[model samples]
Target chain A: MRLFDFFKLSRRGPTSADTAKQRLQVLVALDRKGGGGPDFLPLMQKELLEVIRKYVEIEEERVNVDFQAGTGFSTLEVNIELPSETAKMAV
Target chain B: MRLFDFFKLSRRGPTSADTAKQRLQVLVALDRKGGGGPDFLPLMQKELLEVIRKYVEIEEERVNVDFQAGTGFSTLEVNIELPSETAKMAV
Candidate 1:
């Protein structure tokens, strides 16, 4: 094997950038499939809340679902804040 | 607490949709900051490849850095295919 190839083979695993890239691919693919915004966002959010409710306490404002459309593509962005560990213990 | 509030307090955790939303938010934020296409994409790719090369045997074709600009927003998509476990073992 070439010297550089050997070095490459001995290297560690994926980096944060790799993880980010993989994630972006999935998100972009989903965005493409959904096209602008998924009509089921509210229903999806309701169901999502129900599922999350099983674990930690979160405020409604802590969860957000939004769609951003550019020229040729649109993205669906969701943000949910989890309760802190201390907050969880109090519950 | 109200009946529903009590129930909401006893939830589980974020769902896949929740995760997607969080990830999308970051990606979108990055996209927005980059503004359509980052002029440094080529340089960024070169540096990214160098870093990734330290870990795996990946071809140039396997690493794709693309910008898709829509009407209002743009997305920078990066795709990298690492050497398969079997392929790595063979090396």
Candidate 2:
């Protein structure tokens, strides 16, 4: 049934689902980051830091929000390096 | 030289430049959210709230970090709703 149709689609190499998934992802990313639109990553990072800093004292370098592309995949990594409790108390 | 070469590339349809940009974007987005890898948005949102709560009191629903797919473009939106200073003081 559906499984058979999917298997038939895969004989061409990648399954239809995988290929479709791959194609859709690549198209969307390029348009947003380029396509004459403003890059939102830097903007987002700045605002995020502002909110976090209201309570926590953190160095700018300790906050990282990044989008990394690998092969056919991409990952969004959000990291915050929090200072020790003693450091927070001292401040 | 380059301009003429670019013009030649465009007459066929979308310029190579536009096509490459489009293709790259679509592929990257699909892969990140799918590809059997866990989505990062929910995880990031949860952790983000934990850090923010240390200083300001906020309801869990007030913070949002989301990835949205639209047409050929995708957006990453991070929003945090902060209460008034008076509200913070009351807390």
Best by lDDT: 2
List candidate 2 stretches off by more than 4 Å: A1-38, A69-76, A86-91, B1-91
- Candidate 1, B1-91: lDDT as tens digits: 1212221232236565433221111111111222233232223334434433443356766555665444323334454433323112121
The weakest ten consecutive residues by lDDT in model 1 chain A span: A22-31
- DockQ for each of the predicted structures, in order? 0.02, 0.15
Q: Score candidate 1 by TM-score against the native.
A: 0.27
Query: Against the unseen true structure, what C-alpha lDDT does each candidate score?
Result: 0.33, 0.33
Q: Supply candidate 2's per-residue lDDT for A82.
A: 42
Per-model TM-score on C-alpha atoms: 0.27, 0.26
Off by over 4 Å in 1: A1-91, B1-29, B33-38, B70-74, B86-91
* Residue B37 alpha-carbon offset, candidate 1, angstroms: 9.9
Error of 2 at A6 (Å): 29
